[model samples]
Target chain A: MNKAAASNIYDILDDLPLDSGQVLTGAQIAYETYGELAADRSNAVLICHALTGDQYVASNHPITGKPGWWERMVGPGKPIDTDCHHVICANVIGSCMGSTGPASEASDGAAYAMRFPVITIRDMVRGLMALLDGLKIERLHTVVGGSMGGMQALSLAANWPERAERVLVIASTARHSAQNIAFHEVGRQAIMADPAWADGDYYASGASPDNGLAVARMAAHITYLSEEGLTEKFGRRLQNRKSKSFGFDADFQVESYLRYQGSGFTQRFDANSYLYITRAMDYFDLAEEHGGKLANAFHGTSARFCLVSFDTDWLYPTAESRHIVHALNAAGAKVSFVELSAPNGHDSFLLEHEQLDRVVQGFVE
Target chain B: MNKAAASNIYDILDDLPLDSGQVLTGAQIAYETYGELAADRSNAVLICHALTGDQYVASNHPITGKPGWWERMVGPGKPIDTDCHHVICANVIGSCMGSTGPASEASDGAAYAMRFPVITIRDMVRGLMALLDGLKIERLHTVVGGSMGGMQALSLAANWPERAERVLVIASTARHSAQNIAFHEVGRQAIMADPAWADGDYYASGASPDNGLAVARMAAHITYLSEEGLTEKFGRRLQNRKSKSFGFDADFQVESYLRYQGSGFTQRFDANSYLYITRAMDYFDLAEEHGGKLANAFHGTSARFCLVSFDTDWLYPTAESRHIVHALNAAGAKVSFVELSAPNGHDSFLLEHEQLDRVVQGFVE
Candidate 1:
C-alpha cells in the first residue's frame, strides 16, 4: 500500500464509443488505489464517486489539499479498510479532475470543452471498465458508490454484469426522476448563462464561469442536505453580526455557508465539467436503455446487490433505493436493501455511521 | 363591480417607512377588487398574493393576458365569493406590476434599480395598510394569503391586529428557515451572476438578465411543486421527441416546461423586483419582531386564525403550520388548522381544490 505508487493516471489510446454517436480518442483517466491487488485479483474493490467528487477516495485531494471526501469511511482501519482490501477510485469521464472530460485536451491539443461528446452513466462505467482492462483486473470484489456513484455502480452491474461480484449502491436510483432532471437543468442553465463561460472555451482566456458555477453549486448543494440538517446547522442565525444586514450580503449563516461552498467549488472544479457530468446524470435511465423494464437491465446478472438509503435523503429517497431493490428481486438477483435512519439527507453515504460501516464491512467481506 | 374600475393604482405621496430604516416616497400600489364594498365596510376581504403574484386577483392580468392566478376559487360563486363579499387584492410594494418597486422611477426620474431600499415582509404589509387607509377601510372582514402572502397576513395581524376580523394563512411559516434562505440565496446568486444583470441597471441598456432570471425562476419553480406532482405530470417523458437528443437541449419534458416557465417569466416580471421580494421573504420572522415569543405576536388579537397546509407541500410543510397554530393556541386566540391532502406542493393554494374551496367558504362565512 505505497501511497506514491497507488495513485497515478492511465492513458487509454483506444477510441472510446460514446452514446452521442461519437468516439473519444486518446482519453486519460486519473485514479487512486489503496492496499495491494491480491495475486488472484479477487480482493479489488472499485469505489465510484458522486457528482462533485473525484478520484481522491482514500487519499489527500491534490487540488483541495484536504482529506478525501469519504475519508471517514475508507482509510487504514475504516469500514473500507485499505489493510484488507485494494480499493480503486477513478475520476469519472466528463469530470474535471484529470479525467478525460470537457477540460481534457483533445488529440489536436485543444481542450475538449463543448466539443466533448455527451456521455451517459453507462459511458462513465465504460471508462471504468477500460481502466479495469488496462489494470488486468478480471473482476471486482465489490463495486461501491453513492449518489452518482451509485448510478455508475448500477450501470456497471447492468451493462457489464461479469465485471463485479458484489454491487453495493447507496442512496442512488436506477434512473433520473423528473425532479432530478429539473434541478440539473437549472444548474446547467446557470453555468451557460455566464458570459465568462464563453461557450465553454474560457481556458484560453484565463477566465472561468466561476460565478455561474458557484450559483450552480449552491443550488445543487441544497439538494444534498435535508431541511432539518440545514435548520440544525445554521437556521436563520446571523453571520458575524448581531442583527439582519437588510441588504444583499450574506446575512444568514446558511447564506454564508452556501456562498462559501459555491465560491470554494469554483476554484477546484471546472464549470464545463459541471455541465457535462450533470447532463450525464440527467440522461441516466437504465430501465429505458433496457426496454423500459428495470428488471431487464439485470436479466443475466450474477452479482449480489446491496442497496442502502437514508430515510432523510430526499434527493435519492428510500423509495428510489426500494425501486432498485424491486428490480433486482424481479430479475432473480440476490439483493439486500435497507433504509437507514440518518438526518444528513442524501449525504449520509459519505458521513460517519456505525450501522453503515458495519453493513459495508460485512458486505465487502 | 366593474372590471375596469376594480383594477387600478393608488399613489401615496407620503413617505412609506421600511423595516430597513429607510423611507420610500411617492409609493404606488396596484390593486384589484371584486364585488361592491359594503356601506359598513364589514364585508371587505383583503386577499394577499404570494411572491410573483400581482393584484390581478380575480381578473385578467394585463401583461400575461391570462385569468387571475386564483380565479378558480375567487369568482362570483367560488370560495371568497365576490357575490357575498368584497375582495381586495394588491401587488405588494417592492413588486413590479404597476407597483412602486426596483422597476419604478425614483424622485430624480431614474429607475430605483438597486438603489431601492431592502424591504421585509412587514414593509410589504405596511404598504397594504396604507392602501387600506387610502380606501377608507376601517376593518377587513378577512385577511387571507398563501405562501409569501401568508407572511404578509401574519405580519398584518401581528403588527396591526385590529385591522382584520379574521386571518387565513396557507402553506406558510411565521419565519423563513435556513433552508428557505438558502434557496433564496441561490436564486439571488443566479440572477446577480448574469453579466447582463449589469448591477441591476440592465433596463436602459435594453438587455436584461433574462437568462439569469430564467434560471432563478426555474430553480424556485421546482420548490413550488412536489416531486410527486412533477413525476406524475412529466416523469421521464421527452419533449416532442422520440428519444433522448443526447445533447444539452431540453431533452426531458420537465426541462422544457421549466425552461418555458423561466423564459415566459422574463417577459412579464422584473428581475430586480424578484431579488427584492425574495429578500423580503428571506427576512420574514414574525417572532423576531414580537420579542422572540411567537405567541406574543398574536397577543390580544381578536382575529380568528385559519391555517391550511397541504400534506405534499414540503416547501412550507404541515409542521410549519402546526407551529403557527401552537402559537395561536398559546395566545388564547381562536385558531383552526388543517393539513389537506394535495399532490401539488406549495402551489396548491392557487390550484383548484374542492376541499380548499369549502374551507375558504366556511371560514369567510
Candidate 2:
C-alpha cells in the first residue's frame, strides 16, 4: 500500500479548544497502528512522538524509506511487544504529516498558515484524548513517549488521569527551561528571517524557507548529542580530506555530519510546523497549569509512572526526571525512576540501548 | 580623541607566511596601549583578546560606544597592574575592528572578503609577534589571555618561546573539541545560508546578512553561558508582558535577550570576519601541530605557565585545563593550574570574580 492507504487519519467531529483561546474546526489527526486491538481494547498502547517525529513508530517511513523511529523498541516480541499489544502512534496537531496544521486547509478551503492558533502540550494531549474517544478506547494500557513525546505523556497523565493506566516518560521535562526556550527562539528567528518564508504564506510560491529551517535544525541537533559522544564519533578528524580546506567547506567530520542532518531535516519537516511545535513546547509548564505545584498536576492519579533518563542527556538531564519523580512522590503516585548510563545523550531514547530496552520491557510487562 | 586616533594601527614591513601556504603582504595590526613602557622595556605586558575582541581592551569601544571589553580587569589598579606595566592588547588579524581581516582592503583595493586566506591561532600569534617587533619590544613580562586569546597565548609560548617570560591561559582549550567545531559550523552555515551574504561579497551590497549573523551570534552566545546561570537569570520569565502573545514575538525574556545580543553583535562585527575567526579557532590543535604529543609543544620551555578554568564552564571545562597541566608536567615546565568556582560559565574569565582576580594578581606578581 502507498503512504495514504497505510496511514489512518481521524477527523474530529467537534471543534477543538486551544490554550490560546482559539478554536480549531475540522481537525484531523494522522496515526498508524500495529498489531490488533483486543476485543475490550485493554491491550492498546498509545505512543506520542517528539518534535520532527511522526506516527510511523514500528513501520517504514513513507518519506525517508527508513524504518520507524522506534522500530528497535516497538515490534513483535520487542520491548513494546506488538505481538500481544496493539500499538498506536499519532501525529500531533500543528504538525504537517497529514495532520491539521498550518499546511492544512481551513473551513474556507485555504491553508491556515500564520492564522493557525498557537497550541500547548495540553492541547496536544486533548487531541490524543479525542483520538482515543473516537476509537472507543476509554483507557489505554500505557502511554509511552520521549522528549516532546514525554511531555505529552505527562500531560495526558496529569490532565486526563483516567486515560492511561501506565505512563512511560523518557528524557523529558514537565516544563521548558530558559535555555530550552532560548534555543527554540533562535530556531524560530532563523525560520522567520528567511525571505523565502514569506511570513509563512509560501505554500503557493513553490518555495519554502529550507535554508533557515536547516540552520535551525543544525543548532537543535547539537543539543541532542553529548559532548563526549560527539568527540568519540567525529573528533577533529577531517571530512574526506587529509588536511583542512582553510575555506568555507565542511572540513571536519562533525561539520559534514551536521550539514547532512540540517539538510535532511528540511525534506520531511515543515518550517512553519517546526515553529509552531517548538513554541508549544516552550510554553509547556505542568506546574503552572496545576496552580504552581507540579505535584498538584498528578493529584489523585493512580497511573503507574515509569520515568527513564540518560546520564548524558544534557538537553533534559537526569535532574529534570528527578524533579518529576519528586513531584510524583509528593502526589503519592506509584512511580519508578531510573537514570541509565548512555553515551548518546537525549537522543538515547530512540537509539539502541539494551538497558533502556530492558527497562521498557520490564515496565510494560 | 576619535576612535581612529585612540586605536593605533601598526603596518608590518615584511610579508607574513601563514599555515595555509598563503603569503600575506602589507598586513596591518591595530592595537591599544596603556601606561608607559619602562626604559628597559621589561615592564611590557601583552594582552591577547578573544575571538570577537579588539584593540580597545581597556578603552572605549570605537563602534559600540561602550566601555572596553576588559575594562573590569586591565586598569591601573587591576590584576594586570597597568600602573607598573605597559599593557598592550592587539586585535587578532581575522577580526574586523581596525585589523587586517576579511573586511580589509586587498592589494587590488577591494575588500578581501572570502578571497582572504584562512588563518589559524598560530597565524594570529605571528601577527602579534610582528606587532611587538615593530614596537621594538622583546616581550619580557607576560602574555595574558582568555578563551580564544588563551589559544593565541599558548601558540606564542610554543612557537616563539623567547617572546614572553610568562603565559597565563584562562578558560581555554589547546584544541577545538568536536562539539566546539560542530557549534562553530552551525554558526558558519547560518551566516552562509543567508541570501544577503552573497558568498561573503556583501561589502558593496549595502545589505549584510544581519539576520543570518544574528542567528549565528544567538547560537554561539548560548555556549558562552552556563545552563544554571541562564536559569537563575531568566527562567521562563516573560519579556515586558505578563502573558505570552501567542504569536512569534519575543514573549520570553531569554528570547528578548538573545535577540538583543544577536542584533547588537551584527552592528559592530563583519560576517566574513566571524567566519574566518571561527574557522581559525576550529583548526587549532597544539598536539597535532607538535609531533602528535601535547608535551612536545611545551618541551624545553622556560616560560612560567598558569591556567585558570571555571567550574561552570562547559565550553572549555576544567578537564581541558587539567589536560594541559598534565602535558606541562610531562614537559617539565613550571605550571600552576586552578579551577575557580564561578556561576558564569566560559565567560567567567571576562567577568568579575575575586578568586580569578587573586589568582591573576598572585601569578603576575
DockQ (Cα-based) for each candidate = 0.87, 0.89
Fnat for model 2? Answer: 0.88
TM-score for predicted model 1 compared with the true structure? 0.97
Candidate with maximal DockQ:
2
The list of candidate 1 runs beyond 4 A from truth reads: A1-7, B1-7
Which candidate has the top score in lDDT? 2
The TM-scores of chain A alone, one per candidate, are 0.97, 0.98
lDDT of 2 by residue, A268-298 (tens): 8889999999999999999999999999999
The per-residue C-alpha lDDT of model 2 at residue A250 equals 88
For each model in turn, which proportion of the native inter-chain contacts is also found?
Answer: 0.98, 0.88
lDDT (10s digit) by residue, model 2, range B272-328: 989999999999999999999999999999999999999999999999999999999
Predicted structure 2: clash tally? 0
The per-residue C-alpha lDDT of model 2 at residue A101 equals: 86
Pairs in clash, predicted candidate 2: none
- iRMS (Å) per candidate: 0.8, 0.6
